[model samples]
Target: MQTDEEIGKVAAAVPVIISRALELFLESLLKKACQVTQSRNAKTMTTSHLKQCIELEQQFDFLKDLVASVPDMQGDGEDNHVDGDKGPRRGRKPGSSGRKNGGTGSKGKDKKLSGTDSEQEDESEDTDTDGEEETPQLPPQASHPPAHFQSTPRPLSSRCRG
Candidate 1:
């Protein structure tokens, strides 16, 4: 507790347990970080090395948010960060369908539309909307009823059968 704050009491054993847990965590973290440093052939451990250690092991997954702020030399960006050093998950390509935009991620090449598509483009351009610009009308969105709205019957247990 601070000077003016109320003191909060803790059990003596709690500090010993917390101290042991912290000691083990730091030992593992430093060992992994040191491995990363050796991999880079660097004598000193850097923040990037520590971040790599966190990203390498699933046990360290919880520390991702903290290590994400550390910068790397390569501008690999956040794309590779999601799946960690294992690369893309489920053996999918980096720019594959795992992406949100129907696999047409920013890396996807622009598709060339042809035939009736080109004609429709010209028709839209030729439209004369007097002096006002035409506003595209969007289709109404679909709404889903809450799951709790429907009730399911459950079989009675032998002890509570009526």
Candidate 2:
């Protein structure tokens, strides 16, 4: 029977071992591929090379057998028994992990536009205090209106504003 510390060490190394094993397997599978492609002056891996490595039925069979044997997030060969990681669930309240909002931009009342400012803007435009006559903008051409205007007709109230 392995000691608790030995089991813990092996469990910690499982992910690294799996990743390295996959890397080596892929490198070995691609060993002759570069030479073949280089001789042909091909820019990418050939179709035959891809087909030789990726047998879909065999891959599915292997995965099915693996899942049937293990059938969990934890893989075979060792019982890791990892604890439930205590991070916040998705969309939960932000935790007290050195994060602070500083109480800014959350209140909606601070964003309301004041009535007097809008009234003053309207008064200024109506007066046109620069002494230039407010030229009546000509009715836009039916076929060639401004680039930004849509083809929809404007309301009478919108077009005839004094």
Candidate 3:
């Protein structure tokens, strides 16, 4: 708009037009979401419901990516599970414990794991009376983590925004 000199003055009613369009869109979405919730016998609408609503309607095709990225605010059940976990539902296939960075990120193969229940179970001489290997004691806060352990992620922040 700054460079386009031929374009006439921006109309004052443009804002109102945009507002009306957005309002109609949101109103239709909420209405359809409510219907979907009712069909699913749910008391409250959820992200899954909204996503399904968007997927069902051809007009909402553009918003599929947007809703797909949105995390479900209310985790009701199988429909609202976190991303990648589609749940062992009727149609969807069971999911696997996904490897970090697609099985290439972990340096576990190079690093020797000790007293860990890893796949390479070499019969070491460190067995107890019960024929079970003794678990290694966790390192203190000042020291490094166990050799078997990977990167230590920080704890999650509190939900309350004080």
Predictions ranked by lDDT, top down? 3, 1, 2
Question: Taking the tens digit of each residue's C-alpha lDDT, what string does model 1 give over 86-132?
Answer: 43233334433333323232223222332356644643453333433
Per-residue error for 96 in candidate 3, Å, reads: 45
Q: What TM-score do all the candidates reach, one by one?
A: 0.40, 0.25, 0.40
Stretches of model 2 off by over 4 angstroms after superposition: 1-10, 52-162
Q: What clash count goes with each model? A: 0, 0, 0
**Clashing residue pairs in candidate 1, if any?**
none
When summed lDDT is taken over every stretch of 10 residues in candidate 1, the lowest stretch is 137-146
* Top-scoring candidate (lDDT): 3
As for lDDT, the candidate ahead, 2 or 3, is 3
| TM match of model 2 to true structure | 0.25
* Lowest lDDT block of 10, candidate 3: 124-133
Shift of residue 154 alpha carbon in model 3, Å: 74
- Tens-digit per-residue lDDT, 1-162, candidate 2: 136665644566777898999998668546554544454444445443333333333542443433343323222222223236342222313432211233221122122232456644543454332423244433212223236745789789999989
- Give candidate 1 regions above 4 Å deviation: 1-9, 75-162
Question: lDDT of each structure?
Answer: 0.57, 0.41, 0.58
